[model samples]
Target: MTIEQSPAPSDVADVYDGIGQIYGSAWGPNYHYGYWDDADDTSSIEVATDRLTDMMISGLDVRPGQRVLDVGCGIGHPALRLVRTGDVDVVGISVSHVQVAQANELAAAAGLAEKAKFQFTDAMDMPFPDGSFDAAWAFESMWHMPDRGQVLSEIARVLRPGGHLAIVDVIERGPVSPEGRKVLDHVCENYAVKSLGTVDEYRTALAANGFVDVEIRDISDNCNRTLAVMADAVETKYDELAALVGEEQATSLLAFMRLSAVTPEQGYLYLAAVRA
Candidate 1:
């Protein structure tokens, strides 16, 4: 029988809706994306999460007892981590129902249920009143969004005056040579992703959306190191992970990892920017 077509990016949100459990089984608790350390250290989930969090707070300067929002928070790791600082109320929103449920479960289990909360909601259409938060963060999830501007605008709408938004995301670097563009296009098609924007494009969008103090930090080296580490780790765990996800998915993941390792080398970097 012919295989049914994979869903579009809009549908992708729904696809990941229940994938939080399988999400970590393939990689780890950090969702297995981006660089973990800026000092060229070995990359890992724990390191990446810490690095991203630091970038968020330092860049946005999150204040104690402030209300924060995490767009596309996978499994609520960052949100829970922020809560631990005893200075923020983090509201994590994701299109993935699975992630939200697991995040909530984790938070409640850790007795952080009151300080951190997870919602199954779209980033472009968040459910909150105006000036709902003092700060916001999006870690490596911006590329998954189709309308980055709309998402940013929504984020701005929810943020109070002088509020900050920090985003740690993957952005394309340099002009894609026509041939290289073809290769990238092939990868995007295979993954059913609609698009990936460049660093300049994201900065432009943030600016056009009325975000000030936009900055682009080149952390490609960090991502490259992390990708290499993950490549090695996943190779060793392939068999066990395959047993968990079956042969086809395991193979897909391997291909994905290999491609990602090469992609950053080609011209991709973890970009952290802020709005004030």
Candidate 2:
């Protein structure tokens, strides 16, 4: 299966706009992968997803009264958490019009309309002034970027000098076997992902974009349980998702989840960097 060489904003928007709610229902507020502390940690999906957000918050290390750019923000729950955590203002952007409206409503309902705002914007070409933000984050969204470097350059451009950036994402750790390639292909095809980058590529991309003091953490083991948990969640909500997104997408989601759940090729990592 061939996904676009570079994931277009429209393609990404169509996919999320159609099935954003299904993800919320199955994966809770955040659309990114959850983090499990250990094999013994039996936290619920909500707790695990929140845990990942908290990790980003720590990595961001922004102070009160600062501004954060939430790149590819999905429905704004993570932005709400970040705003409430440090009393910082967050500007979240998403290509999906449906998600931006829903995200704004979520913020307003949470009494965070003043602190958190969501807009329909593409990360590849964000319309923001230079040095507009103190910190930024791209959560599970880079997978959809056709040119991750260009997106990183935009992020770096908008952020102030010394601004910190956090990215909670997945990567290709090493060469995958034929069996794993099938899983990766299905995931990229069905999920509207363009391609997976290796850890070294990530470093090179970040550094090239004027990011310094990079810290890339490999937390795949803790994050691997997400696909398994997601599989169960999707299975439980298959009928509802099928009704919303059609039978074909629902079936593909299940197959993607089933395959990714057992595949170890996808590595999860959260990286932090500071603008020089």
Candidate 3:
């Protein structure tokens, strides 16, 4: 599936440009789910998300000075963490111009301007040349892309032979019941996601794209707390969110978050594959 070079869907851009700051304030810099080691763990969202980031980085096994690409990098926090932890140079890309600008500014302020750079680019049609990166990671970003296969293909194309790709994304476990589908639909619509694919689908796409050593680990239980935390954050900032994005949007967003937290059929997964 080839995605045209036209601008991304307005929902994708608008969601970020409009309430990105507010969302970031609630969701933290990772903008993704957290991985808890223990079921009873009561860590902050930032700490838990950092744990998830560290897991992805470990899977990538990057080295100093190696170039890494961050697909759908929001606010560049995870990319900056990679620079500090692995001494890797990172190029982060996002469809949201607001995020791109903010990410670059954050990188500069953190004294990582040379090490971590961000650009307004799409995952389905990245701007970089083939074999440009040693490693790449998409943290909960693939669901928003119009075509997961095309996005994975692009990731494979930009990665050097033997380069690794690590991803943490929401996945559909199986055919959902009618009630489950309703909740799934609401989450997708509000989140600007096209659809959630299955674990087997992801494995097949990776293999078809010339990626090897594919490993998928279901970490849904560990990551499910992210939605719960987000729901609480929304409630805590209910009026502020309503003021920022209007009452209807805020209400819908909160409902989506709360419902998604309890929906068991929709889950999360961590996948790692190597460009062959």
- TM-score for all models, in order of appearance: 0.83, 0.95, 0.94
Candidate 2 vs candidate 3, TM-score winner: 2
Q: Is candidate 2 or candidate 3 better by lDDT?
A: 2
lDDT of 1: 0.68
Tens digits of per-residue lDDT for model 2, 1-276: 346576778889878876756766877878888989999999999899999999999999999999999999999989999998989999999989989999999999999999999998888898899999999999999988888899999999999999999998777766788888888887787667888777898999998999999999999889889988887887788888989878997887777777776778878888999999
Winner by TM-score? 2
Ranking by TM-score: 2, 3, 1
Better of 1 and 2 by lDDT: 2
- Using lDDT as the measure, the top candidate is 2
Clashing residue pairs in candidate 3 are none
Ranking by lDDT: 2, 3, 1
What is the C-alpha lDDT profile of model 1 across 139-208, one tens digit per residue?
7677677678888999988998788777766555555666556545654554434566677777788888
Candidate 2 TM-score, C-alpha based: 0.95
